[model samples]
Target: MKGVVIIPTYNERENIIPRSGGRRNASQYGIIDAVHKNLPQADVLIVDDASPDGTADVVKQKMKRDPKLHLIEREGKLGLGTAYIRGFGWALEHGYDYAFEMDADFSHDPADLPRFIAEIQKGADLVIGSRYMPGGGVVDWPAKRMILSHYANIYARFGTAAPIKDMTAGFKCYRTEVFKHIRMQEIETDGYGFQIEIDYRVWRAGFRVREIPIIFRDRRMGVSKLNKRIVWQALFLVPRLGLWNLWR
Candidate 1:
């Protein structure tokens, strides 16, 4: 399946806007920087949330020169899941075979993208870049935040009963059919919860889900978007999906 990776950015200019790390942020995993570098064959769909720091400006300048990059500017800071949903639909309309979700702040390493694509080639409909698995880890996060994040993924997995290690993981690749049948419009989470919903749906549908180890480095620049509101949404939505799916 021909594929595209959709990254939603709010304010990542400080980290990637520079001339050096630009390559690290652009290139796909395996050898070097993934987001800003060398995936010449794949298209990058960046959905910017109107970041005040001129993140879109950087992408636009890059796009002017790099034919592989594309941008979608939203009016303001919309929810995370909606941005991805919009991107998914756009990818579908464009007839892309595989769709991906990742972060702009480097929290979800761009270098791991090629790994996601490689797993897709192996017949896995949903390939997750998991941090809890072997060789996967977090760097520079406070111990409290790390624990909170670790258990959140754990809680989402247990509550949803997804047969996976990290259900809340945003780094994922989906076959077109996964998006085609999931009834994305009905997915109500709109935030990080939306990610949980998608993971549960894909698992319930019996699609092949595989976990690939990845070292998730904390972003050296830009503010993170995760917050109590997103956490609350995930906590509230997981049980609902779990209970509802129990009867399905």
Candidate 2:
């Protein structure tokens, strides 16, 4: 089956392409190359939000040599959820059977792309790369941040009553069928809440959701895009979803 990995980027110019002249950690660059190397058959779709740092320009430059590398340049920073939604629409129109959500940074290893595909091939409608699972873990993250993430997942899980350990995880693979059943335009959340809502909706729609262990490392380059607004939105939205499920 055909698949495409969708990466949403904002000011990730330093991460997607190799630097011309600078003492940079090799791992901090070459994200596009790594994705192609690991999953040669799967096309890489980069949905850039017109980053001021020329992230989209770099993607366009590389697109010259690689036919499998595609890009979608948006007007501005439109948020992560919409970027994936746009990518999903494009993939479906192009006849791709599977779509993947992945980070531009090295936090979500490209090498693990195959494992997610393997699970999808084995009958999983949605495959999540889970960090809170037994064999999964986070590397080089502060203890406080790790603790917050762990507890946040617990809150989201019980609040939404979703059968997922890592509901907020962004790294995932979805069979194109899942998107067809889900009301994509009806989703209104972004960031953390967006991930949880998608997972909850898929489960509620009776799709097989599977989790696979993955080692998540903090981003090697660029600053994190997280903020208090995203966190606060998730805090409130989870219980609201719970209430909706109860009334249904």
Candidate 3:
């Protein structure tokens, strides 16, 4: 099965730098290498939002060497949702059977790429890498942040009634058919809310969703993009989607 991993980036130069330690080390190069190591058939699409830190340059350098590496350089710092949407469109145009959403900061493990594909082959339309599920958890996060994430998931689940344990999960694999059915142009939420919104839409469309336990490690390099505005967006968007679902 042909698959493509869509990694959205914004100033991820440090995260993508090649380090000599090991595969456990976080870097964009490490992510691409790990994905190929685990699933050689899968390709990577780096959707860069005009990173001022020369992140796109790094990807271009690698692209010259790796034929499977693809890139889409946007003009500026577009939101996360738009970045992934652009990548998803590219994946579809290229005829990829499966499309994946992953982080460039290495918070999501590349090793699990194969596992997601395995689940997709088993008839799952959307496979989520869930940190809230059994045998799944986060590492090195502060208690306050953990509490916020945990409750955010709870709130999203209750509000959307999406039957997903990790409503805010960013790491996921989707069968191309899911996107073919959903109206992508209508999705507006960005940041973490983007994850919740997509999951709710897919569930509402009656697709089979599956969750696989995954350990989410905080980014070892660079700063996180989470902000108060993002938090608020998610808080309001969940109930809005819920009400929309009921109305429909």
Candidate 4:
């Protein structure tokens, strides 16, 4: 399936548009550029959540020069999941073959996007850039952060009984068929909980889901949108989402 990478941005002024030298965390800088540079054929959709720092402007500027780049400007700061849902609708309407969920802040490696697109082309309905798997890992984080992130995915899999290793992984590719099977309006969660909910629905619909290993690098340009409350909400919501399937 032909695909476009949907990058959700919220106050990513530091990294949204390339200024002189732009933002970098070394390894992260390399991986993000890998896809933006090498995968020139794929379209990139940026959904900016009303960043005051003119993040959308930067994208607009880039859009003038790059046909692959597109932007959707929202009025206020919306959550990550909602921005992606919006982007997905845009992609589907635009006749894209595949839809992707990624972050503009660089947490999810862009270089791994090609792998997800490849999986979609190979007939997997969904592909994830996983961090907890054998070849994948989180770099530059301390033990506690690693444990929380690792076990969160573990708990998500167990709670939702999802076969995939990393249910909460944000970097994912969905075939157009998968999007067709699911109800976008039915999605209720706006934060981290949204990740598990959609994946659970995809699984319930009997779509193939696969995980690819990727070295997740830390974002050096901006503050993380991840919060303690959202973490707690995700901890509580995964099993609830499993139960939500019955209602659907």
- Most lDDT-accurate candidate: 2
lDDT of 2 by residue, 1-248 (tens): 99999999999998887566767554545898888888999999999999999999999999999999999999999999899899989999999999999999889998899999999989999999999889998999889889888998999999999989999899999999888999999988999899999999999999999999999999978998988889998999999999989899
Clashes per candidate, residues 3 or more apart or on different chains? 12, 0, 1, 0
Between candidates 2 and 3, the TM-score winner: 2
* Candidate 3 Cα deviation (angstroms), residue 130: 0.5
Please list the residue runs of candidate 4 whose C-alpha ends up more than 4 Å from where it truly belongs after superposition: 18-34, 244-248
**What TM-score against the true fold does each predicted structure earn?**
0.89, 0.96, 0.95, 0.90
Best by TM-score: 2
Candidate 3 TM-score over all chains jointly: 0.95
lDDT of each: 0.78, 0.92, 0.89, 0.77
| Model 4 lDDT tens row, 1-248 | 46788888887866664455545544434222545774666788888878888888877777777777888998998778788889998998999888788776667766666777678778888888888789988888768878887888888887777887877778888887788889978886766678888888898899998889878777757776778877877877887876765667
TM value for model 2: 0.96
Clashing pairs in 4: none
Candidates sorted by lDDT, best first: 2, 3, 1, 4
RMSD of 2: 1.6
* Two-way lDDT contest, 3 vs 4, winner: 3
lDDT assessment of candidate 1: 0.78
